[model samples]
Target: MTARRRWSTEEILDAAAELLRTSDAESFSVRKLAAALGTDSSSLYRHFRSKTELLRAVADRILLAAMDSYRPEGDWKQRIMSLAQRVREAFGQQPQLAAVWGRHASSGTGSRLVMEEILQALRASGLPDEEIPTRYHRIAVLLAALIAAEAGVSAITPEEYEQGMELFRVAVLGADPGRFPALSHFARDVRPLGADRHAAFEEILATQLAHIETAMRSR
Candidate 1:
């Protein structure tokens, strides 16, 4: 009798990640995955005890792939911007995975590695030791914002999204024009500020890092 070939954990994860990349997460069922892999769903259970665990594994795999491609040799601000852009591209490529990656607690090894790299870069740039945590907090916030923006952009139809942006502009302009004069004047152009969100996020990250560096040096 011939023995059945067992699938490795990495193989299962790769299959799951591909599923998420090509389709929505809603379509990622064990049965569907098994069918795609030409195996029984029971076989998958041997590798992943639950769907959540499998999803996390898939998220980790994709995130690590993203981190592997990050290469920055510049000042902390430039490095961070480059890193942020890589992250944005990664999540954009696999949007369903992005939603899962964004929600998971940053406790996994992959998550830790990414954070450690960011912290190391910041430390190398002369950010004070005491302020390192604050710098990371800012980076985390910017990362979360980028993921959220990408997710939002992926969820809406182009026409509906455009109409929604127009509605947002009207609402903002309707609010205290005297207090937000510039916003009111540019309301048409200010419609939710969705163009090149990753670039906008990079700017925000750079500004925050600069502010932190200045404050730490003063203190």
Candidate 2:
């Protein structure tokens, strides 16, 4: 008879990550995971002390994926844009993982490495050392906003979401014609080509980071 091979921690974590990518994190239970793996729930506890540990492992794996793909060598604006785009892509690929990401403390090794790289790159760009903390905070806010926007948009069909966004554009832009000329122009542009949201996000992030860098240098 052939001997049975035991599952490795990586294998278990990969399975859990697959479940997270395909379904919501809340739906992933040890029992369900074990059943999917052709084992009992007790088997998982040997690898992951508890479900919380399992979730953390899943988060770590996802963060590693994001960090691995990040390339920080370039102009500060380009580097920041690349980092943000990679993050957005990573989350977009696993929307179910967003909830876990949002709730967890940003103290994991993978998370820290990514932040360190970003901070180092920003510092090399002539940004003041004193402003590093503020820059980090702003980057966090920008990432959270991007993740929230992408997750919300993914919840609906693309066509329906586009239509809804168009309607919102009109309402917000048309509310006060003279006071919001740029917004009115924005609505017209969006209504015509339907904004490429990812590209728009990249542009906005680059713009914001540039301003922050400028401000930091002046201080």
Candidate 3:
């Protein structure tokens, strides 16, 4: 009889992180994780109280890795943009995890690391210390939502995305020209030649920063 492999916390989390990258939501359970590590479910249970806790740990590891890989070497805006882009790209690579990233609880050690990185960039922007906290919170939330939308769609199978888009296009074409003229007119180009996601993100980020800086100047 084969003996079960003894899994370390790091080993388990490592496998869990990889599993999250390739597995679907339904296939991402503690039992599957343990099996992947050549251990039993009880072995995983010894470390994590539940599947949710286990997923949270895996998520933290992903975030931690993302933060560590970032090398800041630019202006304040560039550094801040790099931070957001790096995290987004990291999570984006593992579409499964990226899909549910924002739904999970924050304030973990990994999150603290990321937050500190962002605040550091903000400090370099020469913002008053008092306004940093509020700006940090707002920007963090906005960055998360933007990344989620960008990466979550990526996590799905191409077939699924194409199928959804097909439906969307059909609906757009079916819209009344009198009432939804704008949408109907642009139906062909909506998906066939859509705007670049990264460019769209840059536009949004620039607008938000412009508004925030204007408000700061007035106040």
What CA RMSD would you report for each candidate? 3.7, 4.7, 2.6
- State the TM-score for model 1: 0.77
Clashing pairs in 3: none
Task: Kindly report which residue stretches of model 3 are placed more than 4 angstroms away from their true locations once superposed.
Answer: 1-3, 25-27, 106-109, 185-195
User: Candidate 3 lDDT (Cα, whole model)?
Assistant: 0.76
Compared to the true structure, candidate 2 yields what TM-score? 0.72
Residues 1-219 of candidate 2: C-alpha lDDT, one tens digit per residue:
854457899899888888766666577789988987888888789898888778866776666788885666678767777777777777777777766676653456767776887888778778778877788788877777667566656755678977887787668667575887777666555442234777778777877887886776677
lDDT of 1 by residue, 1-219 (tens): 866568899888888888776676566788899988888999999987888778877777656777895676788777777777777777777777877777654455667767877898889878778878887887887786677667767756789887987788668868677888887778756546567775677677778778877886786
Weakest lDDT window of 10 consecutive positions for candidate 3: 187-196
Clashes of each: 0, 0, 0
Top candidate, metric TM-score: 3
- Rate residue 187 of model 3 by lDDT: 67
lDDT of each: 0.75, 0.73, 0.76
lDDT of 3 by residue, 144-188 (tens): 788877776777687987887787877877888899999889866
